[model samples]
Target: MNMLEVFVSSLEEFQPDLVVLSGLHMMEGQTKEMRQKRLLEAVASISDIPMGVPVHLELASMTDPELMSAIIHQQVFPLVNSVGLNEQELLFLTQAASGPHASLASWNGVPDVGVVSDIVFWILKEHGRTPGKASDLTRIHFHTLAYHLLVTVDGYWANQVAAVAAGARVAGTQACATQTIDASRVFLKAPLEFATSKMEEASTVSLNPHEPVSEWHRDGVTFHYTPVLVCKDPLRTVGLGDAISAEGLLYSEIYPH
Candidate 1:
């Protein structure tokens, strides 16, 4: 889109904490499908460091959800350790007595709107053996939602909630603003723990430490990229430089796309 060059060039400049790659709908000349694919490739290819360029696609309508989920599972999640969602956002779509799917069935053509965080609390309360157990059913519903060809607005929120709940956390790992559940935060420890548990239950192959550093080949860009990801700021950069530096720069990338 018009901002791509601006954004990409900025990546070469500010090199901020994390780079999220949404924004393809703004491009004027291409079809939506083409734009999404091009954006996906550019984002995925940004790595010069071993496993450093993990890409995240927001759970948006524009992409093929199954393929996107497959990509996230295969190319991004292992490299990343977190995905955050606001509790209110989840409540907007799902709730105790009904989810968007049920609403659609009832409506036949029109859809009902619900509060995200509010509904999340009710859904968890109703489905779980206990509050803590609710996220499990939420996660199942999410994984299934990702595979659906058509999505209800509620379904979209459900997938996001489920996917993240599947290993997702509250933004910055604090208590849900209204619900009081331990929200997934910006922290790595909780997400890592959740991911490990999910794999164990599903018997899926777990992500291994990324390929060795020396295996990567750089093509003359000066920015340093490392094997693992974590958010970075000026202070963190100083700490990183102390521990790992190449060509006079300390480098780390955040994997949450």
Candidate 2:
């Protein structure tokens, strides 16, 4: 079987409560605002799934405080109840909302294309240039190091509540299009109690903008859907399909039944 068949089978059988559009692993965007907008719109368009629920996402960036806030205000506020960010991300988020890069990037020698929250902090401390309470973006249920937290299906994240526990914290079985994390961000394993006995057919994999992948595979199978998952041969990149085999069979005690 192929990777597409595997993922589709999983989705068809599990029927997860919510879906997470795994950002393809790459980062060369215009800005956080633009990227946030694209991400939000894409997630809003998934066909079969509940729209209202908290979602867990894995990220890796250098410093993009404003960009992160853009995601919160533009996409999350309405669709998501809360979000999860690492300590550094939280710091930048506070600064970015206020129009200052916040410089949260240098907190741990980690630098990327993210905003700097400290810029706002310094400005507020010294210049006081903030026109108004531009930094009143604290209306969120933020969790630190959510990546680490999601590594296990313990009681802390037993319910898949995005950043908290409620009920539906389910993630789509699709591969992330442009997912970049400072470290590894893996969703905990749910024993494969439920399995797709057999796949019927392979579906075409279509990736939206701002989405890229490193390796697309399924159950140890590699996907090769040209023009859909990868770049030109010389400038090749992988899609979510390559992350697993077409038949992503696993030995989990509890499947998504």
Candidate 3:
């Protein structure tokens, strides 16, 4: 059987609450047509369960605007309920979509959170409004060294906050994973007090003092975000985004805050 058949068979057997599609560029397809065909089949097989696609652009795809566009418009935007992008991926998407042209220095230095938020919101809105789209996205996640931002509709505050916390923990675990050789030790620890301090700072300064999590409202959606502990020098970076996206989705489904 082909890749799609295997994926479909697994989906049937597992019946998971959420499905994540990542590293499509790393799949066995030598050509775009083959990859997209498999992607369509996998997406079609998923019925009601929420699907997420993280923009894990490889080096080649990152430089190839055409390939990036096809991946976003043809494969990802149409199928996923939520999409996650790291800092670099977020900047690339914003520039590719002709939304903004801010420098990474600006993002990392002074870090205009409002500008970043606006760009992300615009991307999500555009994707949802696209005509003939296969599915409507319910959430957009932006993970950075400094923080994790979740954009979703109103009344999902609890789920969104839970997702933020889960993502933070996953990120911390990934950092720990880099330091050790054992996979079992990855999720064993995290700095709770550090995360709490950052959260308190973000909530006290950027958002309303009454709310536990930092949030902003725009275009009928609420942005729930929390600061994450950044590894000054991570030993491993691969799959960090995937870890964050997966844990975030899982927690949103299971805990709901």
Candidate 1 Cα misplacement greater than 4 A, ranges:
24-40, 48-58, 61-81, 85-257
Per-residue accuracy of model 3 over 142-218 as CA lDDT, tens digit each: 77766777877444324777888788767866776653234444322211222212112332234332443575566
Error of 1 at 186 (Å): 25
The TM-score between candidate 2 and the true structure equals 0.33
User: Against the true structure, what is each candidate's TM-score?
Assistant: 0.27, 0.33, 0.69
Candidate 2 has its poorest 10 consecutive residues by lDDT at 245-254
Across 112-219, the per-residue lDDT of candidate 2 in tens digits comes to 112222221232222221234322111122222111111121111222222222101111222322233111333322211221111223333333223221112233
1 against 3, candidate with superior lDDT = 3
Per residue, candidate 1 scores C-alpha lDDT tens digits across 52-162 of 333332332222333333333334323222222222223223332235332322222211111222232333344422324311121111111101011111211222222
- The order by descending TM-score is 3, 2, 1
TM-score of 3: 0.69
Q: How large an RMSD does model 1 have?
A: 18.0
* Cα-based lDDT at residue 242, candidate 3: 73
TM-score-better candidate, 1 vs 2:
2
* Candidate 3 pairs with clashing backbones: none
